[model samples]
Target: MRIKVWITSTVIATIGVAAWAHTGATGVVLERMQGMSAMGESIKTLTPMMRGQVPYDADLVRREADAMVGHSGEQMARLFPEGSGGGVSKALPSVWEDSEQFAALAEDLKTAAEGLKLSAGNGLATAQSNDSGSMMGGTTGGMMGGGASSMMGGGMMESNQVMTGEMFANMPADAAFTMVAQTCSACHQKFRKEDE
Candidate 1:
């Protein structure tokens, strides 16, 4: 139940944050925004499955994970070439100033999505199991922020620090999804411009 509410709320918040239109965006910025929106929609598709509102299909989970995997890593990195910022872009200057960290976070997203692909069944299994204890713990702001939310303004990524691929290597699909979400949050909080 905690997981369901958290995931839904997070996704919703992310989309809400990204409610800002891409008005005036051009070139790579627009491309990245579209990519992020697509990812958000993918996550939205999985939300029901994640919450057990819909039946979980391993194939569907893997396919969605593939979508996330496809949009990330180098494909994601290229969206932020040196001069792509400014004008309608909400990207903060830190993206270029802290290039290495920014790029590493992008790679982390790829790694987390891969883990999600590998652990497709485990996500819904855990969701359906009613296991005890706090899976989300400190993740208050949560889930959706960055992937699409960040790309679109990255969504409301939580305050949880980034997790390493090694850490996510054997996690359940739900947990791996969190890893991806947190990475998105971390990047956007650090890099994206605030909605104000």
Candidate 2:
């Protein structure tokens, strides 16, 4: 049930991005938004499998994890430079105000993605233990991909425009995935602006 809610929320958020484009947003601002959007799509692909709504495929899981790993860590941190906040940006002042913690969170995400890849390759999937529900029918549509329309400066994107922890010791994949997501949540809660 919890995974269901998370998946629903992520999907809803990503769907909104589809119609919203980077109008004035260009350069690295747009680049990071697109990176976040891509990461979100990768997480979306894994959720169904994590939910057991779809069959477990190690190859697919590893691929998505790799995609996430690509956008995170130093890669993610480089997108934000000094004086890149405000305007259409959704980033809060703390990103620049508290750069160290933000960078830690980014590194944490990369580490988590790497852990997920390792777990998947080692045959640790939710499908292995029947923790997932029955295979869900049909497919979700219209996730064309966009982000917080018309941003003028460089900044961070929504976490859901991208994509939790040790309570998930049951499966290795689950554990790694939760850790990866927790990093995202932590970064968003502290760095990203609320949708006011």
Candidate 3:
């Protein structure tokens, strides 16, 4: 009877540990999924703006940018496992081992995204007046196709054009693609499976 009881307890303990591990893995997977979904949505929102299919809306841009920045920060922290010695992420232990550096990059992305949102809120005049270049520049809509003009069916304006209602009123779109892209690139380079 003593032996049987001991065996039973051992089995139970093993099961509990297995359950806990599964739960942790699920949390990690879920975080990745949510982060990817948010980025996809941001791209969709920015499509129209990049293509010049619709004029930029300050409110929509700000809302989407805020979401992207917030999610990026939250996801970064969640990514590191509880005590895998800090950086046991599929991202190669280097990330967790040097957490401070990883965190700084994440913060950089958040700040740049926030700046983009602020610029968007100020409207077209702000976009044109400031020749400092985009807070997250590199041709936002090019992922979809040719330059903005081709994508918008010839409605595309010069990069410096003062965005107007006539250009984007019909289509309400957000401008958070570049920001999201940066986060994705950073994560993929540091953590995700390169072969994937």
In candidate 3, the residue pairs with backbone N, CA or C atoms under 3 Å apart (3 or more residues apart, or in different chains) clash, namely 54-168, 55-168, 86-96, 87-96, 91-191
Per-model TM against the reference = 0.71, 0.70, 0.50
Worst 10 residues of 2 by lDDT: 146-155
lDDT of 2 by residue, 57-113 (tens): 878978999999999999999999988877756668998989998887898778668
Between prediction 1 and prediction 3, the one with superior lDDT is: 1
Off by over 4 Å in 1: 1-14, 17-20, 123-170
Better of 1 and 3 by TM-score: 1
RMSD (Cα, Å) of candidate 3? 17.9
Sorted on lDDT, best first, the list reads 1, 2, 3
Which has the greatest lDDT?
A: 1
TM-score of 3: 0.50
lDDT by residue (tens digit), candidate 1, 76-166: 8889999888887877889899988888778877876887788675554345335554242223123332222232233223235454444
Candidates by TM-score, descending order: 1, 2, 3
lDDT of each: 0.64, 0.60, 0.44
Query: Model 1, poorest ten-residue lDDT window?
Result: 147-156
